[model samples]
Target: MTTSRLARRLLRPPGVYAPQLDTRLLLGALRQEHLVGGAELLDVGTGTGALALSAARRGARVTALDVSHRAVLTARLNARRSRLRVRVLHGDMASLADLTWDLVVSNPPYVPSPRARVPARGPARAWDAGPDGRAVLDTVCDGAADALRPGGVLLLVHSALCGTDATLRKLEGSGLRAAVHRRAVAPYGPVLRSRLPWLRENGLVTDEQPGEELVVIRAVRV
Candidate 1:
């Protein structure tokens, strides 16, 4: 099989978070970094290991983290099948305290839900963040500076509905220089389409447009 076709086929298994436009979007920005092969990289919330695998393919020393058991297993399988050495771990950012990386990338659970608290299990755990959609995003921003080496870079992607300005302010407050590196409009997926009424009711969506703006935030620790 051709490389691209094989890559698409090996991407995900049942019940794992499939790589979507957000994943592709992050990878797109990553390519712009012109990262050296030996760079230490971390992929947080690494669904299906797509981003992690991409970096590994480019010769990065990659460590991937996911809260879901299935995602961890899937990522490991993909890594092994592709003959790449990715350290797949099952935990959140708190679990990586002792290690530091030159670059950290994440496509976290940023969908705003009606619930006040985040889910611990089930498919919702992959995407159903709290009401304002910044639950896990906040968690990552809180410790990203500490998780990086000096001069490290953190690349993260999420919806604009979660407040791009808020993410920038939080990262900057934590002592990192941050900015929105890219923005793209994506058609609402099943999750957002189902929440249209609730989103509109909450004023998260101002018009009938069936699209959401996604922003890739890049933060650097100097």
Candidate 2:
């Protein structure tokens, strides 16, 4: 049971899984800022429990939830392998039930295209937000304030070309103060590439824009 095998087994889907770079970057930055500790942490869309495990390693009490059963199982097994305790569950993001936390982190679905291609077995529920890429983000923004304790924080990662501005607006509208905490540029995948021209024609992207990029937003529930 290599770590990669464990991760792959947990994240194995029929199509493509969103890369874990954004989650890693956000967690790394949180560590640098002393944001996460042994506090109660909730990781929404916890694919393979990457962020959950990372936080657990740093002594945070982590609860990771995903809509995918395979993803939940993979996260549990990964936690066992790492000798960390992360409670993984299968559930919808908007309806979290009675659970609450001091910190909530998510890499929700933010694909703007309506027909984006994703792996069938991967945690697509965590990637394909909606037609404009703000479906899941809006819900997260709406639910985060109730999910977190006062002054708690929520970190989200999404494509800059999608609905980053809209996401910020939703968070603010939800009474959370939001900020662009991090940004990273990367090439768009096949799906984004196929839709880039359409997005450009619609003024979503510039004519000479390279591809898609990612922006990580950190918001606090005040």
| Maximum-TM-score candidate | 1
Lowest lDDT sum, 10 consecutive residues, model 2, at 9-18
Error of 2 at 14 (Å): 4.7
lDDT of 1: 0.90
Q: Which residue runs of candidate 2 sit more than 4 Å off their true CA positions? A: 1-18, 33-37, 116-126
Error of 1 at 149 (Å): 1.1
Error of 1 at 10 (Å): 2.4
lDDT of 2 by residue, 1-222 (tens): 234444454444443243455655666555654545568888888776777877887788988887777777877877897788988888755556587777888887777755544434543555665556776667777888789888888888888866678878888888889999888777777667777767776677896767667888888878
TM-score of each: 0.94, 0.84
Each prediction's number of clashing residue pairs? 0, 7
